[model samples]
Target: MAAFLEAVPARIRTLGAYQPGKSIRQAEQESGVSCIKLASNENPYGPSPLAVAAMQRELAGVNFYPDQDSLDLRAALATYAGVQPEQVLPTAGSSDLILLLLRLLLGPGSNAVGGDLSFFLYRIMTKSVGGTLKQVPMVNHAYDLDAIAAAIDHNTRVVLLANPNNPTGTLFTADEFERFLDKVPARVVVALDEAYSDYAEEFAVRRNVVWSRAFDYVRQGRNVLVLRTFSKAHGLAAVRCGWGAGPAELIGMLAKLRTLFSVSSVAQAAALAALGDLEHIHKSAIANAEGEAALSHALAEAGYPGVPTWGNFIFVETGEPALEVAAKLEKQGVIVRPMKAWGAPTAIRVSIGTSAQNELFLTAFRKVMPAH
Candidate 1:
């Protein structure tokens, strides 16, 4: 068994596991206070009422296996995205879809390009499939699409762009995205991850969905794959439903490689119902917008400045060790993600929470970081 396991490729042996934000349960066990987790950027408002009802309805059918094709959910998503059913493939979550894309496109000798400050999962997934990974440094906390395109080489097969990027909570403009797409070679696939796209607001414009532009580009023969999640907007993170949209052929190939019953029956029903709950989505958006402002103002008052966020989180530079600050915050029952993992040592990313939770974290932060 040892010899067999050791036969694994050197690249696989050297891989580091992806680090997700610590759970509230872990924080509660450590801090002794029921933790107010502002980590992971999950929807604080939770799943829509309709989604809960749908899940409850499916509870009696737990013994039945889920649909291997997730046909109903895919059809519902196609309706929501205004794309053909063939263009959409629903997975357990967007993360699974991303992994499937990498697996389908990447292999030994092929390289992948991704923003250094974007979702860390992109790097992990690309490397896991033996793809050489190139990291493009972000400009002003936003994904530098030019840098990403420039890094692409002949061997590059995929480019992963996480919009409204995690940890940093920044985004690329439409013009910049178009320029990047134009520069990318036809042989390579461009994956646009819109996990938090629902919360993204345009510069000087109101918040609205922008994924249609991505899909339109794909429809025009571009090798673009767009990913979205029910996690953030629909508050179905626990349910784990997400999908990808692109050419039918590309989606078909990915679908073939995906495991059977990737999404549970309950999850599919919950996602379908959540898609129709426009009111809940609106409430979550409003909560996130207000929470972002509140957190930013609180950070400023505490003498730490925060990055402008279009998602349900803010990245703030604390002028101190992020790990230490995070530890301090954790002790106070406010769990946040430190940016050290992303090589931003002086920054800590805080997920926007309810007003009460925000005030609690602010008070705790002030106490831990009193004026010298």
Candidate 2:
């Protein structure tokens, strides 16, 4: 019998698919309760009011196709990113951009240097192309820039770093990045995935260390790309709109590879509207910071002090198996994420939910793990 699975590439066949946190609907079905989703690092506040209005208005045009070139959205994004329209490419969330970058850079005999503890998408995307993923171990849940620099060799074509990295929520400061950038070869493209950077602050703090810094390097023709999205701070996760800024030539190449009309018209409209509503983003940031602090305080009192987080999530150490602990919380309608997929079986990464959601999760934690 002919089998499609048998024909799959050896590398992809062996690789496990990327695992997202359990969806709210899926959790509700299992527990027969309204589940509080603290699994995926989603904004609890939801999308901006203006974005909602824009998407609603755009629904009438759904029968027609989206703007294939996405010119208007690109122009708006360029203004927001402080770059020229030719240098920014809108994508279907940052993940899409990540896949596109991986598709372009990786092929036979090519490899990328990345941290083992950073975003797992890099691992999946690299191997899907049969390219080697050189994973450098992290130090203190942050990118060990020195280790990443050391890992790059002759075959290294790309270096993937997660700014304010996921699962751990650690950050690589601007100064640390400049030092690392100095060490990287000119030929290697450094892909900085800064999806959570928006939550790190109010979109700007001109310290020469920012997504704009990478944008500056891009304009200078350096091989660099900064990946980000509306999903995090803007509360537009379901819209799936994201973007990247880089050299015009590089942006041209990515634009070429991007599927026609891949980003929906509604998403583009929503993103444009959301960009104008910075106040909503600021409120969401404040809520996330407060929720994270509350969670951290509870954990510290329980003797499980979590590592510092710059993003809207915290990594909590459970003295027992994290998966089991997460399961216990799930039974109580609390859905937090276990870190096994990120290589830490004894830790869980809980997204900062609303005040009520966080309290529910904290109460469930007390019932499940009970302090000593």
Candidate 3:
């Protein structure tokens, strides 16, 4: 029986599970202090007050199942992204949607292309669905679109590029994406993972520039999907609501595989309200941008090189092994994400928090690496 178990599909047997950041409570348990967690790029500001209020309103009807189609939320997202409601497919979160797309698009003998140091989940999902993971090495901590374009081959079924990539906090400009789009083959689906799009400086979540144009590719019969999430800006990571914008045919295929009622009634309600509250989203964006700038300046002044970031985080090259530095910071109640899993051994990716939390992280970082 043991030998039989070991003979499972080669894809499943060799696959590595996705490793998320340690929770603040876990950090506190390990360090014996109330920790400041700038690890996962979760919004430190809790969900918008409007979203919380809406969730409370829906609590009275907990017995009822949510609309499986996510009609209201999808409609709201369409309005938010300036697309028709048919183009939007809301899900439990972006992670689930990503897996769903991978399952629908790629399988054994196929491959998905993404940056080596971008989100690691893409590789995990691709491999889990029996697809080869083709990683193009990033140039100077940013997604090298030309290299990624060059890596695509005949077996490639999909291409996942995270604009304002995670862990690195680096972004692709509109022109860069245009150049890549001109070269990308029409046969494969290109997914621009814009989970942190709301946190960007120039491009707010609206119908403008590369963002709107990316979906236009889908509308023009090109296979492209733009992934977005409410987790970051809405601060609804707990609620776990997100969505995708793409061609109706592609979205419909993913929808067939999407788990019915995966999103709870409360989550749908909360996310609906979150989408409507643009003022609150604006405030959160401002806070993240300011926090990122302050952290970047501080890192520079302290003689540490940090990546130029448009998202709500800073990726710092710590010179020492990031895991060791992160472990040391853990002892001081600071939990920043180590990028070893993403093939960055000497870098720590810190999410933007409130001013007080940022100060705590900076203080801990200084203590961990003294002026030398």
Candidate 4:
């Protein structure tokens, strides 16, 4: 090992980097075919038109530094989320806020608790700070809230959870979350990641499932942080803007530790614009619901029934090695996420795309997936 490598912390040396889904360009290059990527759970409809105009308008200001506090964007998010502006902290993305929280609360002797197979970032961020992440085993592909609460101990500094969780698209009800929150110690901060909250909320209304009450907790002065992002339904993934709302004091502390100008001027402007475009978000949700239903029905007919999903993705068992299945689909110009890293070698998580993209995926899937 190099001398510099020897000096590096063991946690830093052993940490595994996050593996993102394959991009369209990468897939096209490897397969020699044009591809539609459904692996990343991005909005196929693209960013809000208002957001595009905002970004274009903000282009001339790139030469200047962004507002260090992101005051305007935070105020917009506060209005949208029904929180006070002082209680909101804007970051580059929700992932960045996750890191900031861990750095503030976790240390060598501390730990965080989260469900196994939840968002991969909770584990990565906790470990990155030399803190342990107790991944309580999930039940039926959903978060086992009771098990997660039981896993928390005196040294546990944070609890990480994602509503309509990534990879699985499973969510707990508002009532369930309330009960779980009651069990958590006041000393431990709960970071409720609502990255897919918009989709989940729409699904909740149609399916009669209760959506998360994270913001409610924040309003009630609970020791919790609600994290949301513009990367998903808003289609601002490229710009990378997100925020965390919690107690005013906690938000103030995180704001102090936040990197200067972390959110670019363009990103801030785009997110602000996206926040006002309720029509685009609603349209995206309606399309996602329809695509999810169509894909689920089609997959079930083709012998691949998937878990009921609240987010814009479905977790389906392929009954074969997932990586092999994913590779085969890639060759047919479709891309999806294999769940091997999350421990289900026979499952793949497919993001709901636009009608045309979804059809393209189904065609490729039918060709690659053997008939039962």
lDDT of each: 0.85, 0.85, 0.85, 0.91
Ten residues in a row with the worst lDDT in model 3? 203-212
Each prediction's RMSD to truth: 1.9, 2.1, 2.3, 1.0
Judge candidate 1 at residue 365 and give its lDDT. Answer: 83
Q: Poorest 10 consecutive residues of model 2 by lDDT? A: 203-212
Q: Can you tell me which runs of candidate 2 are displaced by over 4 Å?
A: 202-212
Clashes of 4: 0
- Candidate 4 C-alpha lDDT tens digits along 249-274: 99988888888888999999999999
- Model 4 clash pairs? none
| Deviation in Å, model 3, residue 24 alpha carbon | 1.5
lDDT of 2 at 340: 79
| Residue ranges of candidate 3 with Cα displaced over 4 Å | 1-7, 202-212
Each candidate structure's TM-score, on Cα atoms with residue i matched to residue i, is 0.95, 0.95, 0.95, 0.98
Colliding residue pairs in candidate 2? none
Error at 230, model 2, angstroms = 0.9
Question: Per-residue lDDT tens digits of candidate 1, residues 171-221?
Answer: 777767887899999998889888887788432146453423677775676
- List residue ranges in candidate 1 displaced over 4 A: 201-212, 370-372
The per-candidate count of clashes, in order, stands at 0, 0, 0, 0
Better model by lDDT: candidate 1 vs candidate 4? 4
RMSD of 4: 1.0
The CA-based lDDT of model 4 is what? 0.91
